[model samples]
Target: MAKSLLFIPDISGFTKFVQTTEVAHSQHVIAELLEVLIEANTEELQLAEVEGDALFFYREGELLSQEKLLAQIENMFTAFTGHLKLLEKNRICPCKACATAPKLELKIVAHCGDIEFLEVQGNRKPFGKQVIEAHRLLKNSVESDNYVLISKELSSDIELPIYYYSKVFRFKQGKDTYDQKEVEYIYSIIDSNKLNISEYSKAKEVVFDKPPGIVFDRNFAIPAESLLEYITNLSYRHLWVHGVDKFEYTENEVTRLGSEHICVINNKHLNFVAVKKKVKPGKYVYGEMTRSIPIADTLYQFYTISPISENSCSLKIELYWETKSILKKLLITLFAKKVLMKNTKTGLDLLFKLTEDSRSIPSSK
Candidate 1:
């Protein structure tokens, strides 16, 4: 006997989507959507086979990290919706399937239990009651078309974030009278919108008392939306930001207006503190270096992005410093400007590289 994690990501509204839509084009859309889902599979997960409208994936060994699994699920959802949007935009056929395919939704059901693999004709297939239970869970009582339901048994083994709220459901098994213990299952509705897969904070337009001390601009070969996600989403931001030591988010933070973070940066073994200003999504992000005993409130940074083409965009950043101090203003003009330009250029190049790599993935359009 082996204990393993069993999960299925099932597509909802798929039957209706295909039935009324053009068969040839609808099949292409389904195949494209499934390919995107399969690409999200990590090395930790072993994919068994593709069921009609869902993919069967499992990981045998220790319990998988809930956070990583949750991220993968969210990533797949983003990809799914993104490609669907492309299909909708580029559709030429006035068929029902192409028109309604964007309405398809996804849900995941996960569980952990004893499992055994049976080899028939050299193909590996999972079998046992636990496997059946995992499949049965797909036909759940969840009202939402989009959700992730982890069995209460597996949920207990791993601690989910505080944001996830769960509900109890008593599923009647084919009119069989049984105790509540047999039918009772607790699951959580994954609020995809609440999850900050790609978020940034900003107002309509950032205002400064005067002109910035330094500015840098460059074009990137990625869409503004992808660049926005890279900049706004802290999870993705940390991967590329240089000298990031740690970050402290505001209480129950999810990257919105009035949300703040104390970003600690390591500069040649010395730690400096910077505070993120309130961010409005899709506009701009501003931050300032906080005053320590030795550091002054002089340094500030602002970011703004604009679209260039269907697959490209322009990024602009301005660094400002207090010019009230005559001596400090002279010092920055003579020396600091060069250094700021070099560092800002390097960071933007790295950002461009990251966004370009992100766009390399296969998309519907």
Candidate 2:
């Protein structure tokens, strides 16, 4: 048996918060906050499991200094509060979950004792009385909603000032009563200011009104480079796109960044212009387009090509455009989405067939 520290950082007011908030948004907030807490793990700490709204962590071998252990606890508290404030300030949704996210708080319990490690089904399982004691400490009579509770068993090993801020509690456990003096460190009394968010200071940025309307994905039995060439080069686009009679460049240039093409689809004229945004060769191409339709001022489009093997790749096309009027939104939701989905599916199928054919000619150099 070896000595180690057992830690459980749990969220307070979780049940009440969830009950008073929207289901989907509350679930998202909980997940995000949990992720933020888990990201505070240090090399000295080992994450054991995420037990619902709490994170169970422990470190084996030599005991950590009291100063270092307290510092880690403070770090987690600060992270939790910082993320909570950021979400509170940035949330635009009017749901109760988004509006009351800042009300959530964190509390942690720490203890140290002997534990024997065992491997069961390729997973490490820590078995000891200390583990059970640490969990029981979570239900202690600490009056503060957000505070750190360290058991007297572990505090005895640390040379820290505990007499100034300690509390004693007696509770029953499994037909047996136990008494232990614990230390409480209130969070708000330490430093109760909101953290400066310099990295995410967006004061004058236009947010998109809505997400993408349709997303289509497929795997092609061909190289990404070859498929990208077929998609980008207008000389080859007319062969795969249905009802496209011609695609001629306006400036006598090829289809590329800042390039424009005049397309006649079944005698209905439309102009297509490209403004390259972010391009990762053989991986993805993201750009904006201005067309003849009134589907917002510009449409956002991206093609993500993920290579599965040396000769096969996956393609995901995302289309995003906003409708201004309520009638337009209703039309898009009721009818336009189906039409767009069908057209997108047809285009991808044609591209797949054309790319798979051995006789398909390469774009001219």
Candidate 2 segments exceeding 4 Å error: 163-191, 194-200, 203-365
| Lowest lDDT block of 10, candidate 2 | 166-175
Instruction: Give candidate 1's error at residue 160 in angstroms.
Output: 3.1
Local accuracy by lDDT, each model:
0.62, 0.66
lDDT of model 1 at residue 201? 27
TM-score of 1: 0.48
Give per-residue lDDT, candidate 1, residue 83.
Answer: 59
Estimate the TM-score of every prediction: 0.48, 0.51
lDDT of 1: 0.62
* lDDT minimum window of 10 residues, candidate 1: 168-177
lDDT of 1 by residue, 1-365 (tens): 44688978888887877677555556666777788788867545788889978989888755677677566666677666665655554433334565687788888777888888898888897888878888887776667787777776676677754346422221211111122335334454555455433432232333467777778888878766556556644555555666568655532222332334556665423222333433445443434343331222456666666667867777778786654667666767777778777877777877777876767522221
Predicted structure with the largest TM-score when compared to the true one? 2
